[model samples]
Target: MDRLTAFVSGAVQGVGFRWWTRSQALELGLAGSATNRADGRVEVVAEGPRPALEDLLARLGEQPSARARPGRVDAVVDLWTPARGVQGFRSR
Candidate 1:
C-alpha cells in the first residue's frame, strides 16, 4: 500500500476537476479525496498501490490522454508516502 498527495494547478476549480479525479481514483481501486484549495490548486490524495498512485499522478498531469483530463492542467506536484488507509474516493 502507498499514499500519493498531488497538488494540481492551473484552471482546475469549478470545472469538474475533483469529479474527474474521483473517477480515476475509484477506477484504480484507490481510496482518497480530491479537494479544491484556496490557493487556486486542487489537492489530490490517494491511498493504494504505488503503481496505481503513480498512474493517478500521471493522469492528474494529463499525460497519455489529454482529452480525459478536465480543464487545463499546467502542473502536478506530488509526494509519496506510506498509506494511511482511506475509505473511499470522493470529490470535495
Candidate 2:
C-alpha cells in the first residue's frame, strides 16, 4: 500500500472540500483525513493501494463544486502504519 499526503492551496476551505474529499476517498477505499490549515490550505492524508490512492488524488483535483479555484496540489508518497484505526474521514 502507498500512503499519500497532499497539501492543497487556494480557495479550498469553506467550500465543502473536506466533505467532498471524504466522500471521494471512501469511494476509492482509502483511509485518511483532511484538515484545513491556518495558512489557508487543506491537508489531506490518505493510505491505500497505489492505484486507488492515485485515483483519490485525481478525484480531489476535480471536485466540481468544491474544487479550489486556481488551486495547487502538492503530494508526497510514504509509508504509514496507523497505531490505531481511523474511523472515517473527517474535517478537523
Candidate 3:
C-alpha cells in the first residue's frame, strides 16, 4: 500500500470538495481523509495500492465533464509516504 498526501489549491472550500474526494477515494478502495485547512486548501490523504492511489490523483485533476470536479482547481501538489494502515476514507 502507498500513502499519498495531496494539497489542493483554488476554489475548494464550501464546495463539496471533501465529500467528492471521499466518494472517489471510496470508489478506489482507498482509506484516508480529505481535510480543509485554515489556509483555504484541501488536504487529501489516501492510503491504498499505488495504482489505485494514482488513479485517485488522476481523478483529482479531472477535466470538466458530466460529473465535473466540485470546484475550480488550480493546482495539486502531493507527496508519497509509506502506508500506515489507514482504515476508511472520510471527509473531515
Task: Tell me how candidate 2 scores on lDDT.
Answer: 0.70
lDDT digits (tens) for residues 1-92 of candidate 3: 89999999989999999999998899899999999999999999999999999999888876662456789788899999999998988888
C-alpha TM-scores of all predictions: 0.93, 0.72, 0.94
Candidate 2 clashing pairs, residues 3+ apart or interchain:
none
Lowest lDDT 10-mer window, candidate 1? 61-70
TM-score of 3: 0.94
RMSD, model 3, all Cα superposed? Answer: 1.1
Which candidate comes out best when scored by TM-score?
3
In model 1, what is the error at residue 24, expressed in angstroms? Answer: 0.5
Q: Which has the higher lDDT value, candidate number 1 or candidate number 3? A: 3
The candidates, ranked best first by TM-score, are 3, 1, 2
- Local distance difference test scores for all models: 0.88, 0.70, 0.91
**Which number leads on lDDT?**
3
